[model samples]
Target: MDSTQELIAQGMKQSVPWVRTAGIEFTEISDGRVVATLPDVAEQRNHVGGPHAAVMFGLGETATGAVVLAAFSDVLDRAVPLVVSAEVRFTKLALGPLRAEAVLGRPAEEVLAELDAGTRPEFPVHVTISNAEGVTTGELTVRWTLRPNR
Candidate 1:
């Protein structure tokens, strides 16, 4: 497994409520990218009987944070990344299992450099949550900040 995959596996083993509750599982990680899946179950359903917006948001946040953490592992020092800001838009009602992916793309190097400068870099990660049909159910742009622990 690569560094990104290893990191995501470690995170899965130490699953939190937000992950377990939503049945979110890390499926893939590479470079500065992360993909997580969330099953559409009764627990994740909203009053309208569709996936709750909060659950989708949680998956996006988790995926984005994982990308930033993987990209700046040196600065993170195994520390957890936090979301400083996020903008989410619900494009359609989500039903069934959903996949959320975050990709750092080619800008990873520049973002890592900024983090190394110790200026508390805010990495903007794009998260796309889609249903089985590959239709995007929601989109989120999350800004994650990494803090090194002494």
Candidate 2:
């Protein structure tokens, strides 16, 4: 795995215990975007044999949080990202393996600048969760804050 993926995996392994059970695997991580996958597993299925809504929401949050953290990874010694609120919508039943892509509205440079200036900035990350058939099954808007780690 690459450095970004390794860092994501390490974070999940060390702190986010629930993400592992949900099968949230980091696929891509960049300055302003992150992608993850939630495998279609029997353990995660609902009574109707489809992926549960919670799985998508959890993966969405995880994906968005990963991107925000990756965007601020360089300043870990001074600041950290925290999810203040999350709004999620379940559009349809997510079937098959699900993939979630989270995009940051602001570029990484702008975000880092805010942190460098010792300002707590909040940004919204939009996440779209799709199934193997490429149908959007859910959406998440996560508001994260970059603040000094106190």
| lDDT per residue (tens digit) for residues 66-147 in model 1 | 6765676565553457778889999998888999999873476676666567555567789899999999999999877665
Question: What is the Cα root-mean-square deviation between model 1 and the actual structure?
Answer: 2.4
lDDT of 2 by residue, 1-150 (tens): 587768876796468888877778887887788889988899888888888777778889988888877777787787767899999998888778999999997777887787778788888999999989989999999998888876
The estimated TM-scores of all candidates read 0.85, 0.90
Error of 1 at 84 (Å): 1.0
The numbered model that scores best in lDDT is: 2
TM-score of 2: 0.90
Instruction: Report the lDDT of model 1 for residue 34.
Output: 88
Residue 73 accuracy (lDDT) in model 1: 59
Model 1 C-alpha lDDT versus the unseen true structure: 0.77
